[model samples]
Target: MLSTSMTSAVIPIRTVYGEASTGTSSQPMNGTVVHEQQVRTARSYQAALSDWKRWAADHAYALHTIQPEAWSSNGGSIAHDKFSDLDMLIPLLADKRIVYLGENSHGVAEFNLVKTRLIQYMHQTLGFNIVAFESGLGDAALAQGQIKMTATQETMMRSIFGVWWTKETKPLFEYMKETHKSESPLRLTGFDIQVQSPLFQNANWIPSNGLKDRALQAEQEVHKWRMSKDLSGFRKAKRELIKVYEELLQVVTKNENALKMDYPDEPHIVKLMKRALEDRIRVIQEFNELCIQSNILTEQEDYSASQSMMEWRDRAMASNLAWLATEIYPEENIIVWGHNGHISKAQSLISTMPKSMGELMSKELQQESYVMGLFMGEGQAAENTREPVQLDPIIPGSMEDILSAAGQPYTFMDLRYRENERGNSWIFERMIASYQVMMPMSLELRRHFDGVLLIKQVKMPTYLPHKVTKQIG
Candidate 1:
């Protein structure tokens, strides 16, 4: 269980523009003090805005405006003209083997559509064949198999996508199905951690009676130990569960011949069983590690532990992506989709954090990886409470502010060679602002991404499917 108490000393308050108070001082005459205080506050606001405006004007050349019609036909299927804005980005995409499309959140419909169109363009023109998402690796693999087997789109959406199940994402799933008809079909993969879901237990590969019962029993035992406040006992039970899963994996692998003989009519059952067992083993291993961290770390160290877990998850994603690129599709280009934070190439806000997936892959792949960060200047953003809130205007001295000042409805700026060629300055190093999980965060732009895609306005994703609601319930 997590702590519910607030640990920080500071109180959070909203800042209202032009609401600064003039200070009252007893040392001086009241009229003089009030006049001087008001002058100081007014000067401060004006100076900050002026400084930001100067920076924006100086760096305006670094940005390239992107028209909405460049990527989408609005509703048509015709090819984009050579003069379209995507023409400016085609060379950039062509130079990289992997492209990371980072979103601010999972609920922005316009951003999702932009990504979908990009994926379609890459698939149709550039021949990028694999699309990897930040979802559970095991669950996505299972869902892909189901999709290939003609499963309902609703089932695939519910089983694999989690919060990314809005109607804006429907085209992605439809594309995957349509691509399956080609000689060289497109692939969808998940590269996140093994988040254990109930869907995995009913994957048609696990035996309905005995094996499923044993697996559930092991999980229950671990949960029982966890809730009892017996850390050592929990660790012990978790390790035992790990062994059970490992043994089950070995059994499935070693007896493939005999298993095939027993289930003669369903030869693919053995492979599915192997996948299921492997997924179980990975989940148990992750669970045990979490238990160990919980036992060793104190309550104050909870945040540190969380950062460690986040790094661990990103490393796992990078490793899985490497596996897919090398072992699964050696000749194919890969595209990754996820939030800006996880896909950033720069260090996160936490100082001790390790490289994110994008950073790690960029280092390994060098020029083969390209990362793009997306931003919205103002719009409605979805929250976890199933409500949408209006986004406050971009903050002064932030990247979004600079972009908004450019007066472009959409823009794409290449950051890879800007600092080296255009001279390193404060504008190149300023932190970019974004909202994550409904909270605002600022990150360095040039260090984290190679390019940015900015949309002047956005709207909440309203086309969430019934399956998503049902699954959440």
Candidate 2:
């Protein structure tokens, strides 16, 4: 059962066939009818647990009861909540390079406990430093042989992102600040990579260590590609441009493999290798296109735009390498954080990270350095999702199939707050209204680092209301 604190007071209603439901009432409602229509828009959710159940059966996963960490007045510690996903994610977190916290998944209380406890385990039990996050000032502290993180600094970053910090995040941030204070904290540094490229700068875009710019680069690249006349020319120039990426992947893979051989039980080491390989391939592909489309790489004349792009890439890559190379402390443990797209997926700085910063450090960086990505809600929440898809824990099924199984009405009635659209519980109200109708599968992806947790959410629900009804004879 879903947590009650997460429940909404307003009941969302669906009009099955009544006059008021279908907008044929004697006195048509102002917007209640619209809300009702939204409530009846979809069906129910189920589980296709055959494969997962088999895996669970094969493994010796203790069914640890997961519940929200009910805090005591003293604030020292308390019992952990039993979560269905805990057993699934623990093995992955045993020994890994990166822990991905999928979008918004960790943001919630239940998921946050899984993530924070894993970090604690990594730091306290295993001798691992360098905790990373989806946000942060990267590599700057790495070069200084220290990570400087303060609770105040975190509050500032939270303000930047407009994310309201909860009691759950407090301990995690506190741990990070106290543990890595000597070392530079893995600040959530959201920089626009495209603007660092001269091309975007020339077009009036200034690069900032801001999420807005980092988020905007893909579209910018696409736009530049679309506007260019000879994309092939750019591709040709970029054919050899991804050499740095290939080298980074090769080195990380070899080093990670060596670490695995030394400690085969280190699951985090193995997982990092797999993630890095994927990231390397992606960067090479994207960079190749950028080089070819710009044609600036092979231009007979100096193309400032191409230079600017290259410079931007160089700077970002340099910063990442500098951190990875110089930041490791034999006496202290550190963890870094960055977005899933930057740390988990194939196109990030880790797999295809450049060597300049390593050179800057002079002492060759070891493969023992672990890198992981944290995910929030689902893996794809950061991606474009304009349409509805049944991609969650609930299995794919029709409306009647779900409602019949839940033994609940295929419809709900819209009641409280029908007059106010932007009520305090609007989003929740909307979700309740939407979920009652469109039961979706809750499929999620997760990766764990050496006792660190990372999860990605998929098939998330939004504001769009879906209506589902049984095609009864």
Candidate 3:
């Protein structure tokens, strides 16, 4: 039975004629008129379950259950089986110019490991040369230099990403270092905004400890002047800070020709450095705008301004990705790593938000972009809480529930190819949240992602071996 709201909602209808008149009278022909409605009746819980079972049976080939051991075996270096579904999936993924892999949260260790291994496999077999991350551009550029120099995993991890500093990421950093030394070196880049304020404080920004200390001292002086309401002193400190960034940019740009001539073995690193310099300049400009807004905007307007800044940030990431695809690695395939929220191709439920980075990329790349979303059934993840919390059970009628009922420990469903009409309807009807509780108000799963990687359970990411301290620039 349909609820009042369901029945009252805009139901599509089709009209039909009961019979045709044999006598062709221009104005006085009488015939029976019938309204045949094409209504989509709401299904009961039992009905939906029955439908799901039928749909699952009809599309069995498209659903694959991945063995957990397959992923855990050999420390994520699973030996490829010619008949394996995963083996088949890789070739399909290789066809795309860009592939996006999304995680539910940054704190999922299991997911991260799987992603890292997948990246390695893709690079080894598919000729993907560049791996773009969600970290600040300046930070990634610094980490790239460290990796090239074969820096310790600890140093590389600490220097690269502000959010991804966990011990679980150690393997990935080590992989990058090893790959950087190879004849065909893989490139690492970042396509996010420079969120770190007083940018020099970011460990990834400056090369040497001396420059780091000098930048820190400059930051301190600027803060002190601001606290004292000393405009002249604050302006002087700000000028010094900007000058340092400008001088650094000049140094990097000036070495371009020399780097190309002397370091012809790895000329790509110089290109990355130039990109980082450009991003730093943009960060300074954004910081100045923030200061102006803080002084002039009202409380309500201030919130609006922040929202605008966030939208601008997403746009900036999209722009950076476009630049990378066209100018940097035009001939090579690229892989993008980011959270599901940033990479979903659908518009966010929030009315004020614009289309996400994924949506923009899909629009620009069209058939060339392949997006894969990762979801978990039940597990622990870090969210708004300080510690990791247990995930709620899959909600009935949700995408997770349907996928869970398929009885797969791990599964991959390709959204592009579906033969059963009912199965297509079931999969496309709703979008599933990575975490069960964070389901969106509305979503079209088929429109957002090309494939789904479902894991039965997950674990919280491990922190760095040493005492973990959160650093905010």
* Candidate 3 runs further than 4 Å off: 1-45, 53-79, 180-183, 195-241, 257-266, 287-303, 384-386, 431-440, 465-473
CA lDDT of every candidate: 0.60, 0.32, 0.59
Candidate 3 shows a clash count of 0
In the predicted model 3, the residue pairs found to clash are: none
Tens digits of per-residue lDDT, candidate 2, 29-137, equal 6744423232233221112222223322232223232223333333223333423324354343445343333322322343444446555555444444454432222
* Backbone Cα, N, C clashes tallied per candidate: 0, 97, 0
Q: In candidate 1, what are the lDDT values of residues 341-458, reduced to their tens digit? A: 7788775643566567776663567468888888887788675344687777655445666566666676666777564322223335445356353344445567778888777788
Tell me the deviation in Å of residue 321 in model 1. 1.4
Residue 454 of model 2, lDDT score:
22
Ranking by lDDT: 1, 3, 2
lDDT by residue (216-288, candidate 3, tens digit) is 6654443343234233444455666667656666655655664444333344667766676566556444543
Candidate 2 deviant stretches above 4 angstroms: 1-52, 60-111, 136-167, 178-322, 327-334, 345-473
Q: Which ten residues in a row have the lowest lDDT in candidate 3?
A: 10-19
The global Cα lDDT (0 to 1) of model 3 is 0.59
Task: Estimate the Cα RMSD of every predicted model relative to the unseen true structure.
Answer: 10.2, 20.0, 7.2
